[model samples]
Target: MTNKLKAFIFPLALTLVSPVTLGETLRPEGLLSLRELPIEEGSADIQRLQITDRSGMVLVDTDKALPLIENEYSPNSYDGYTAKLLAERQTKITAIDLQGERYDLLSPSTRSGDYLLLITREEGNGAYNFNLRFRYDATAKSFDLNQVLLNENNSECDHSLLSTYSIDRKILGVISIANFDGRRVFGVLKELRLAHQTSGNMAEKLMPETVASNFDAALKAYKVGDAQALKTLVGYFLSGDEDGDCEPGNYIVEKYYFPQKVGWSNDLGFLFEQAGHYPEAVELLQHITRKHPDRVVAYLNLADAYWALGEREQARQAYGQYHEKMTAAQKQARIPPRVLERK
Candidate 1:
C-alpha cells in the first residue's frame, strides 16, 4: 500500500475471563477451541460442532443443546446430542427487541472462556435479532443465554452483518461489517470493541513504533513499484522474527494482517494498476482475492493486471471469476470494455 503507513490503534475492552497476564504466552491447552467439528459420512449438509473452554471442557455442544454435563471431546461424540439449528433452510432464528423490530442473526460464533457469542437470524425478516451471549456457569454447570442489543436501529437500509471474531492477548475483538457502494466488502468493522464484552473502558493500544517504522519502509517500497521490496516485506513477516524487526526476514507479521486492513490493499492495488506496475498489482491483487474470495472488484483488478502482463490464461480466469460473482445490476452497470473485448 503506497499511502502513508498509519498505525492501527486497537480499541480494546477486556472480557472477565480467568485473569492471565497480558502478552503472556497462553499454552495451547489454555485456549478455547471454536473450530468446526468434523462431519460424518453422508452428512454433508449437517454443520454440527462443539465449543470447548480453555481447560478443554465442553461448554456448548450444538448436537446436544444446553447443560453440557460431560466433556465428550470427540467430533463423533455428538451423535447423542441434538444439533442446534442456526437457521431453517432459507430462514434463521431471530429475536424481538423492545421496539418489537426484527433483524438478521450474525454468524460464526465468538467464544472466550465459558462465554460463547452467537448471532441467529429472525425468520421471515432478513435482519439480525441480537447478539446472544451464552455464559457457562460452573456453579450450575449450565449455560445461560443473555441478550446483548445492538445500539444502531437503522431499519430502512436492510443492513448486512459481517463479523470477524478474534481474541488477542486476553481481549476479544469483533469487527463489524462495512459496505462500500457496489463492493459490499465484508471485514472487521471499525467499532473495534472486543466481542462478548459489553463494557468499553479501554484506551487505544498502539502498535509498537518499530513495527510502524518497518511498515513505513514497506510502504515506501510499494510506492516506488519495487517488487523486491514487496517480496522482502512478505518474507520479513513470514520469517517469524519479533514484531517490528524489519531485517529482510526477521519481522513477525501474521499473513492475515494485510487482509484485515479492510480495503487498504485494494485501494493500493488501484494505485499500482494506474502506475502500470502490473507485476506489483498482480501480486497484491492476488493476495486480496485469496483473502476475500467474495470481493469481485479484486478479481477485476487482477484480471486487468494479468491482461496487462500478457498472462492470457490467468487474465481469463480472473475475468471469469469477476463476471461469475457480479450481480445483475453490476453486470449491466458500466461493463468493463476489456471483458467485452476479451479474445
Candidate 2:
C-alpha cells in the first residue's frame, strides 16, 4: 500500500477499535427499544428488526425495502446464505454515525445536546455496508430518519464516507474518499449546517449556512477595506496547529475555508492590494495562479501586484502571459493600458 492509502486506512483502523464515546443517550421517549423480530419461514432466513413507539407503530423496519440491498444479491444459494449470516453477526449499533456504519463518532465537541442513533448492516458477502441514521425530535417525541450512508470495499477499489460534527458551530463536516486508481486518491470535504432548533426533518434542515455567512462577511470586510476584519476571517478558517498526516484540523481549511469561494485566493489578493498590503497581495495572487492556472484573470491581477512591489521583471512576465491569453478585442479594448506598457 502507498503512503496516502496508509494515511487514510491507519487512522480509520484505530477508530474502529477505539471509538470515542459521546456518553449520551440517543434514544428518545416513547420510542421503544430496537427489537429483532422473528423471521417468517418464507422470508428466506433473513432477520428483521424494527423500531416502534409505545403505541407499537413501526417507525423503521429492516425487513422493508432498503436502498442499498434491494438488488444486491440473488436468492437461495450457499454464498448468499453465508453472506446474510455474516451480515447479521457483524451488525453494529452506535451513538454516532459515520464510515459505512462503523461505530466511531469522532468530533471536536458535542455540546449541542442533540441525539443520534446509528445502525450499520453488512450486506453481500461483506463487501458492502449500509449505515442508517436516526435523529430524535424533542417536540414530536419521535425519531426522524436522517441519512443512509454506504461503504464499499472490493478488489477494485475502496470508497467510503467519513463525517464529524461541530456542535457549537452546528456544522456537520463530511469527507468522501475514492481510491479507485492504485496510488491516486481523491477526497472532498463538505461542511453542512444543521438547523438552529431541531424541529424539522434533517434533510430540510441541513444547508450550507455557515459557508454563506462566512462568504458574506468576507465580502463585506473587503468592500469596506477593513484589512483587520479580512485577516480575522482568514485566521478563523485557516489556522491549524496539529501535527500528523490527514489531521482533522488540516481538513478544516480544505472544507470550510479555501473551497467556499470562487477565485478566493485571487480575491483576497486584490483585497490586500487595495488595502496597500503589497507583500500579502503578491503572495496570495501567486498562490492562486499556481493552484488554478486556468483562471486567466488571475495573471492580470498578479502582474499589477508584482509591479506595486517593485518586481519589474516578474511583473513583465505576468503581464506578457495575460496579454497572450486575451482575445484581440480584449487586448485592444479590455486590457489595462499599464499592462501593454509594462509588457
Candidate 3:
C-alpha cells in the first residue's frame, strides 16, 4: 500500500460519526450496576474473578468462595428487567444442543462503565465445549442478547474455563477465548466503541487489505532480510503524528478495528529487536506478555530487547520470570542446546 493509503487506514482515535450514513449511533443512558448472582449449579469452581475499567483501574476484586450447583439445569427466577434479560440468556443456552454436561457461572455479573461482560461455561461432551458472553448494556440496564460472544472449541485437547483479559483504553482484549488456534491463543481484540456499522452492531472488523497490505509489506521486507526497510515501514505504523495520535489522517469507516494477532505482534517485535530498535521492540513485546502471558517466548524476547537497550535490571527481571515459569522439559524443548549449556 502507498504511504498515503496506509496513513488513511490506522487512525489514533476513531470518529464516532461515520461519513457513510449507516445504522443509528448507540448512546449509553444510565449508570451500570453490578451484582454477584449466586451460582446454583454444577462443579465448575471459581478460578479467578476481577473487574477493571479501560485504564486498568481495578473496580472490584473478589476471591471469595463461589456457590456452585449440580449438572441439571435449574433456571434462575427473577422479575426485574435486567434480571429477566439474564434469565432469558440462561434459558436459551439450556435449550441449545451444545453437548453440554454442565454450566458454570464464571463470575457474578460485573459492569465496567457502559459494558457488562457476563461469562457462562458449558462443559463439553468430550471435545465440544464453549463459554458464552452475555454482553449487557449498562445504559439501557439490559442485556444485549444479540451481542453475545461465544468462545467455543471442539478440539480434542482439554481446555480451561478461565481466560485472561485486558482493556487498553476503549478496547477489550480477551485472550485464548475467541482467538485460540488449538495450541497458541491468538486473541480476539474488540474495541468497545458504541457505534453501528453496515456489517452489524457491535461487530469487530478484521484488519482489512488496506491495513494488511502494510503488514504484508513489512513481511516482504523481512523475508528478504532487509532489516532497514522492515524497520522503516514498522516505524511508520508505530509513529505518531504531531498530536501524538497513532492513527493520523485516516477516515475510520469501521466502527471497530481489531489489532493484529499476538503471533503477528511477536514477529514484528523480534524483528524490531534484530534491527536494534530496542524501545519499539520493548513496547510491542510488553503488550504480548500482558495479553498472552502463556507465551513464554515473548518474555524471553522482551528480556533480550531490554538487555539490548542496556536496561539490565529490567532484563534480569524478565529473564527471572521466564526461568521461573519454564519446566525442565519445557526449557529443554524451547531453549536451544547451545543456550542450555550455559544454564
Candidate 4:
C-alpha cells in the first residue's frame, strides 16, 4: 500500500452510540416477554423462561429444547451462540428483573429491530445450567424459539466464544472453543449465508486477485477517511464460508498476502493500533510474534498496544524483547524515545 493508502486506512474515528432505553417492554412493538418458574414443585431453584411476547403470543413452552452446540465439541458442547453469549458479557446481555424473576436480556445496544432473547439459569457452582434462545423477526413480526446454546465451563475444562459482525452483509461469524482429546481448539460455527452476489462477476469472487484488489480498495477508502466504505470492504474480505469452515479473507492474508509482503502482519497490526483498535492490534501483533518471530518491529508494536491497554507488565516484556533483538545502531536510530525511556 502507498503512503496515500496508509493515510486512508488508518485514522478513522469510532463513534459511540448510547443504548436505547428499555423499560418493561422491548422494542419493535414490545414483541418479547419473560417469566420465572420454580425448577420443581416448591423448589427454591428458579427457571427464567420465555413464555411469550408482550402481546401474549406463546413462543416456546418446552424446557427440553435442543440447542445448537459448537460443531467441534458436538456430543460434548452446547451451541456456539451460547458460548458467545457467555464470553462477551459486556456486549451480549444484561441482568434485569422482570416481575420478580432475574433474566438476562439481550443488551439494548444490540437492538436492530431483530431481537435475540437468551434465557439462562445459574447453578450453585455459578455455571449456567439451562440455556434457551428465542428470536423476534422484525419483518415477519413473529417471535419464535430459535435454538438453545448451552455451554458450561468447569474446573477441568474451559471455553471461549468470539464473534464478529459484518455491518455490510448482516452476517455474524462465530469462533467457539472446545476441548478435543486433551487439547483445546477453536471451531467455526455455522455462518449466515453470504448475501447474493452478481453471477459471473470475477470481481465478486474470493480469489487471490479479487482479494488483492479489494484490499487495495479498502486501503484507498481508508486513505480518503471513508469509514463506512473501509469497513464494508474489510467486512466483505473477512466474510466467513457458508459452511463455517474458514474465513476466506484471513486465508488470503495468511496464504497469499503475508508471503508476498515481508512484515505484512506487522504492518497490519500497526494499522489496527493506529486506528484505535488496541485489542485487535494486540491480537494481531501477538499472532505475528508467534508465527514470524523474526519480525522484530512487531514486538515494538505489540508493546505499544499493551501499553495503550494499560498492561504495563506485558508492555515492558514486549519492549524488553524488542530491545534485546535490536543492535546498538538500530536501537539508537529506530527505537522510539518512549521505549528507551520506559526501558
Best by TM-score: 2
Model 3, 1-343: lDDT tens digits are 1111111222122112111214434343332233343322232322222333345444433322122222243343211111111222221222111333223222223332233333333222332222223343434334332333333222322231111122221133233122212111112212121122122333322332334566678789988989889878766544343545333112111111224356766776776687676776787777778867887878888888888888878887877677767763366466634223322
Residue-pair clashes per prediction, in order, are 14, 0, 6, 8
The predictions' CA RMSDs to the true structure, in order, are 20.3, 15.2, 21.8, 19.5
Query: Where is model 3 poorest over a 10-residue stretch in terms of lDDT?
Result: 1-10
- Across 1-343, the per-residue lDDT of candidate 2 in tens digits comes to 1111111111110101222335633222454445444332333433333455568776544432211222235443211110010011111223322233333332222222222333334233333333333444546544444433332222122222222222221122221111011011101111112131232123211113344456568679877878888767644433233332233222322233232244665665665565555665666667667767667888888898888889999999999888887853365578888988998
Better structure of 1 and 3 per lDDT: 1
Best first by TM-score, ranked: 2, 3, 4, 1
Instruction: Write model 4 residue lDDT over 158-191, tens digit each, in one string.
Output: 2111111112211212111110110110121111
182 in model 2: Cα distance from truth in Å?
25
RMSD of 4: 19.5
lDDT of 1: 0.42
**TM-score of structure candidate 4:** 0.32
lDDT winner between 3 and 4, please give it: 4
- What digit string (tens of lDDT, one per residue) describes model 1 on residues 1-343? 1212123233122232342435543222232455344443332323334555557776544432211211134442222211121211111123233234433332223233344444323223332233334445556544455323332222332222222222231122222111011011111211323333363223211122233455567667777878677657544322212343222111111112243453655755654565565666676788778878877788888888899889999999988778777754466465576775662
Every model's TM-score: 0.30, 0.38, 0.36, 0.32
Would you give me the overall lDDT of model 4? 0.42
